[model samples]
Target: MLLLRQRGSLSASQLADELEVSTRTILRDIEALSAAGVPVYVNRGRNGGFSLLPGFRAELMGLNQEEALALLTAGSIGGRQVFGLGSALSSAMRKVVDAIPAGHQAAATDAAQRILFEPQADLLSRYRLAEGISETVMNEVRRSVLDGRKLRIHYAAEGRDAAWRHVDPIGLVTVRERSYLLALVDGHDRTYRLSRVLAAEALAAPAERPSEVNLAQLWEARSARFRAGEVQFIVAARLDPARREELAETALAIVHETAESDGWLRMELTFQDLRHAAWAIWKLGVDAEALSPPELRDVLHQHAVEIAARYSPRGPTLATDA
Candidate 1:
């Protein structure tokens, strides 16, 4: 309907191609619009197309108090920066507040203010390394995804040199602070970190993608496959509450945690492998103790013995050791 109103006329195939849907779907949408009393009509010729009646304008729907408050609180969640729509979100939020009944507006505003959402980090003071995304590069990638066009990108993957590649972008996903571009490279599934995109170009050619895509499902499937390939090493350990932040930062996953009578946290944690487990537990020093996996305990015991031997006053001097 917006397309017809703006362009005056566009063929069914043209609308389908522009919107990335089937012509049958476009026809159904047209029918729905007509049934909804939109002033839409079809031209009957080879060059003919659909058009809206002259001077027709869609009415803006008003929101109730609860809906306005929900939008207000949600808009404050810091996600609008994903596509650079922060200003637009702010404007929309203002409109929502103003559109609501004046008597309810102040109450809604107060309620929204009291309902606080947790930020990206928890209260443990764990450090998180955020991926840096360039605005110019992001804009280009976003364009490719929205326009359904092929994208040429200069990307630097982990442990690899930056290089150019062409991909058909399916969608962009933002998980917490990091963003990913789900695309196809050489007709195979590939996911690229948006921060790793040094530069990008939106090509005129349309992207080769499925007509319908479930980005969430696709991301989950890829994540599951990736996790399945990693080594799972679980370590049972007791940690001090004061050092919880340090443990959370280093461990791959914390399986379970229980508070002991001695005020220490007994935890079953996961690491990439035995080496990772050893390094993490050792870094915690006396604040943590590894209970299970005798191998880990043995490694720590040997490390402590070596340290004791090095500092022992009665031990051999450097000259004697050499």
Candidate 2:
């Protein structure tokens, strides 16, 4: 029933392909469902397929109070189209609603509605273009991952031109609404963000991935490295009390700390690289001041001087003015 609801109709062969079974199996199952009083029928022609009668729906999986609350805690992430699970999540959400006792559905809906998700208005935006991904290319990418096959992809990395490459697509995931394919390139793992994928062709050859692939474990390891100060530097900054929470978001862990005069916080933080610290503190502006590590302070000073120069009036030499 769920499958029929997800797709209005399917031929026997198509159902067999999806279920990894023979067409005879699907035909027998169809007969059994009909025998059980299901409103299933088939159209016998070139454009015909098996379909459920209109307004027919099967009973949904039950959701206990804890399960309902857990889905509610997911907080519409399932509906955000992240990882392309929106349809499945929507169907699941409908099931959750349906499985609730008649008297409790309204209460569940009301509780979910009470939660709000507010995203910051960062200088960089995350919305997609109107003319989004090509259906053909995205389909091939997904096919390769699900089928455990290799892929020939035209990918572009940051600050470089696009190039075509062969990859073994292990899995695909969405982090912060951004899509990425975790694949093996040149026998090493690499994360290719979807925005950088210009084109893709799914290859029939099986991927050279490990027999046991764990997406969660792989993502966690990569994320830890990314947050662990790539170049490994110690940052000493005098931060205003107001920016305390802001600093927590960037650092992997707070290595050390101390109190300062006038409610300011002197902290020892870690960053991936020097460039990382430079670009990061630049944003905090006056809220944070790099104290130790002369190199970091130098970077900030140079940036400040440059900004001052841009706003300074274009003028003749001082001697000429005199």
Candidate 3:
């Protein structure tokens, strides 16, 4: 309708291409709009096409204070781009901006800029990594998930080539600028990076999933299980006061900790596994020490010995001890 009103007239094929629908669907919509008394009309000549009655300007949809504010805020956050809805969101937001009572639009625009979501403190390292996504493919996956239908995806895991699989998509999520699709394959939940998906096809077959699904609960449960590790171990360490914040970022959790008279922190923490704890302590360098759980200390010692041996002309002989 907007296109008809603004451009005066548009052919059915033009509308179909612009909206990514079949010409038949476009014609059906024209008939439906006319039947609904929307004043839509079609002309039948070389320069003739679909158009609205002369001087038509449809009134915009109504929006409440909270709803209007949400649209403004959401546009600022760029969530639309993550879901491949950038163009659609832009069109919707333009309508919303037009619909907002003239008196409130300026205030709404000003309010959105005050809040921000910063994922990384260092701006230089915070680069967007999303790649190889097309708006059409994303919309297909999104629609299938919402429609309770299965999707045929050509997925490539971390080090594998893409292979087609029919999976039940549970939900989609965006963290930072990357998007993820959580789905079920062979009755097990798996998370796939949207960037790694080579193609997507919304299948007609219904998805096999629980009647009622809570993606958030499922995501958290799966994350906890994956992090809980096969063998849970406790790590005790003496961490430097200045490196406290840095250490916090490295460890999964600090079970317990206290300040010592010498300005070090005596702490017990959980590690997903032995290797996780070793790598974390290794990052702390001289500022932290793994003090207990003989295995953790042993691994740290082994890592340090190997690192030192690499520089010592004493060679592979000493590196073997590590």
Candidate 4:
């Protein structure tokens, strides 16, 4: 309809043919348009079909109820963070909504009211340093990947007291709610958590990005294969049937349940890490068991040892080697 208006005027049959719809549909569309305050005009006799009054804005004739409502919702979310752009987005949303048919306004408003988005705590908190560094590195890395350029970064590893090597940033990934930078260090692709990073600077000199190793493909493959030492440790656990169903919905572990035997259901799971798994098992207390990857069993044992040491007759104290 707006496009037809831009062309000055067209008959109902002409609009139906242009829009690839029936003539009745075009008449109904014109009626809806006019009812929405659009200056649509019709002329009778040999040469007249429909036309917009002179000086009428064409953009005002384009939006439908659904599109207007979606824009309004997006504008609200955007305005909460980037103030300047948010205001402009909100203004554009208003104009589009106002252009929609008045009869559809209530429906659009209702739809907008139903939409909701929950922002993450980490994102809401102004972690300026982490955000700024992550943004710069990601943008530069993406540009470098496209342009086939190399990057130098200063990073720190978890459990290490000092910052290590100037690495070539290859790709980035997010696993278990944390972000990591995947890079090539000494000819091998290594993953480094962004939270552990201290500082990163791109060397003026650029190295050629390798064609054989596509960062995105490599990340997907590694993620699928469940690569070792990738910030998460896999721990196997056996859970009772009742508990298995509760854990099935979580990404933290993959659970497999067995048939109930003697009124107790048996199941197994692969945990993302030991610390939380141990704590959870302690809560389940008697129903869960840390099955494999000796380290996980060791973690459970250590917890017990700590508890024993805390309440021992001599009071909490570490046993010293003779």
Question: Largest TM-score belongs to which candidate?
Answer: 3
Query: Which candidate model has the greater lDDT, 2 or 3?
Result: 3
Per-model TM-score, in order, reads 0.60, 0.63, 0.64, 0.49
Higher lDDT: candidate 2 or 4? Answer: 2
Per-residue lDDT of candidate 4, residues 28-137 (tens digit):
99999889998888887898889888766544576687688877677655223231133345446556665777678678877877886543435568432323235455
Q: Who is ahead in lDDT, 3 or 4?
A: 3
TM-score of 1: 0.60
Instruction: Estimate, for each residue in 1-322, the C-alpha lDDT of model 2 and write its tens digit.
Output: 5566547788999988766679999999999999999999888899789999977767766777667866865746432555445455766766676676656767877777776554433348654332245556777898899889999999889889999999998888775556788999778978888877899999989999887878999998877766663548889888887888887777666778788877888898888768888877888889899886899999889999999999887677754774
For lDDT, the strongest prediction is: 1
Model 3: residue 90 alpha-carbon error in angstroms: 1.1
* Candidate 4 backbone collisions, by pair: none
Native-structure RMSD, model 1: 14.2
lDDT of 3: 0.81
Per-model clash counts, in order, read: 0, 3, 0, 0
lDDT of each: 0.84, 0.78, 0.81, 0.62
* lDDT at residue 130 of model 1 (Cα atoms): 60
